[model samples]
Target: MKGATMKTTMEKLGIIASYSRPRVSNDNPFSEALFRTCKYRPDWPTKGFATKDDAQAWVKSFTGWYNEEHLHSAIRFVTPAARHAGHDRATLANRASLYANARSQNPERWSGKTRNWQPAGAVWLNPETEISAPEIRDAA
Candidate 1:
């Protein structure tokens, strides 16, 4: 922000970050998703922040909660911190066991297999399809 106009906006809002590179509107999906999460948070202020400090403090708290506590559905409901610390594998195994036990206790209640507690293999903003051996052979 080179002008006073943008500075006023910043003061009212807080530290504004550009997720994309300089002079580019092409933000990656991951950054876009994170921004969505921040905007959709239950405690996100509807009105502008009283001061930039207030906004920064709120963002810090949100980041902590997101990393340390929030269970991500894409990652088998484990916190990013837990996954980063290599604790998610154990956590997922425990959940799988618990689900299996519950299913055994009331097998008829379950219409299908219990939800997969397996750790996510990989994450891609835009996943590409790989050709299977059978498909390649048939094509050839």
Candidate 2:
């Protein structure tokens, strides 16, 4: 009864529970992915961090690597930092050029056009299908 009441209250407030459906994997994909990355890291201690300071240090390091070094495939294999700083355009362009060169040098080895290698103009976690014209124009 208490759970049902709380759910009703939340609904009235326009709040949705993440695990509303049973046996459904509808959680935020980005957060789940980041957690998986952290859990699978080779440096992650099996037993957990020894102290608060240790946890903080590891988190700092992981955040640095995740933002600056990790090549996120969602963003065309560019690091978050590079994409945020508007440097991904040049990086993607360079990659595209390299792929073109490689394909030209070994024509027989390739069967299709080089990878798109185009920097995504905008990355959305959960985008709406009917995006506004203004948002599209701004992204361009």
Candidate 3:
């Protein structure tokens, strides 16, 4: 396998390789955001895990916190678990009502409209180009 390149191996296996454009940040935003969130966590070990078991334990704990407790900004500050369990609607509605009440009490405090608490419509990891949709629709 020393001289076997990825392209050659893929060709032999009948797998087509479709690569992203160089330096395109949108290509893997979800994964990139997750890594950033994990690395920037306050409890991330600076000294590194002493053993594989320690690392695994830490990862398990982190996963629990991330999915169950952390309020994701992109998803309107609701926990992933709540979103998965179909609870985000009520949570976001409660927040929106609270904000509206506060705004009504002190109109001067807010200069503009309250934060948009609308649920995120569609999330894409590697979204298609804007032109692709129209082209596909026209073709169809």
Candidate 4:
């Protein structure tokens, strides 16, 4: 089918073509987050990438830092690499203990409770909402 004919057929079938937002927002929250972090990195080039190899090398370095060095707030301030390696639990526990000890020695320094170091259970771009099943009607 040609462009116009296909569009008309899609319209009849209640199908709509997505035009805008090509690569800007791909609906992956995780990717969007990583992209935001990558853009904000201090080493992000002010000018565009010079060459394909330069871009690839930059991406590789950024990936290394993002996964191994950067502490992610969503995952209880643990690096993705640490979390993947099953080290986040111990890291968070150590943080909780440190915070507690600090607060005990300097109670006046803290106005509120210490930050929660508990592991973030699950990550979701859009959490699911409750849905009810459609009612069935008898047909004669």
Candidate 2 residue pairs in clash (backbone atoms < 3 Å)? none
* Every candidate's CA RMSD: 12.3, 6.9, 6.2, 7.7
Q: What are the per-residue Cα lDDT tens digits for candidate 4 across 1-140?
A: 34987776655554444454546574455667778888899999989799999999999999899899999888988999999888999999999999999999999999999999987787754446312222111110
C-alpha local distance difference test of each model? 0.81, 0.81, 0.79, 0.78
Model 1, span 1-140: residue lDDT tens: 56867655554554343445654655455777798898899999989689999999999999999999999999999999999899999999999999999999999999999999999988654445344445544543
Question: How would you order the candidates by TM-score, starting with the best?
Answer: 2, 3, 4, 1
lDDT of 1 at 73: 96
| Model 1, backbone clash pairs (residues 3+ apart or across chains), number | 0
Q: Which portions of model 1 miss their true places by more than 4 Å? A: 1-28, 127-140
Candidate 3 on 1-140: residue-level lDDT in tens?
Answer: 33448666655554434466655965556677788888888999889999999999989999999999999887999988999898999999999999999999999999999999978676544455433434543543
Better of 2 and 3 by TM-score: 2
What is the per-residue lDDT of model 2 for residues 1-140, given as tens digits with 9 covering 90 to 100?
A: 25987776655554444554543575566677888999998898889999999999999999999999999988899999999999999999999999999999999999988889998767765565445545544553
Better of 1 and 3 by TM-score: 3
TM-score of each: 0.67, 0.75, 0.72, 0.69
What is the Cα-based TM-score of model 3?
0.72
Model 4 regions lying over 4 Å from their true place: 1-30, 129-140
Candidate 1: the clashing residue pairs are none
Once model 1 is optimally superposed onto the true structure by TM-score, how far is the C-alpha of residue 57 displaced, in angstroms? 0.7
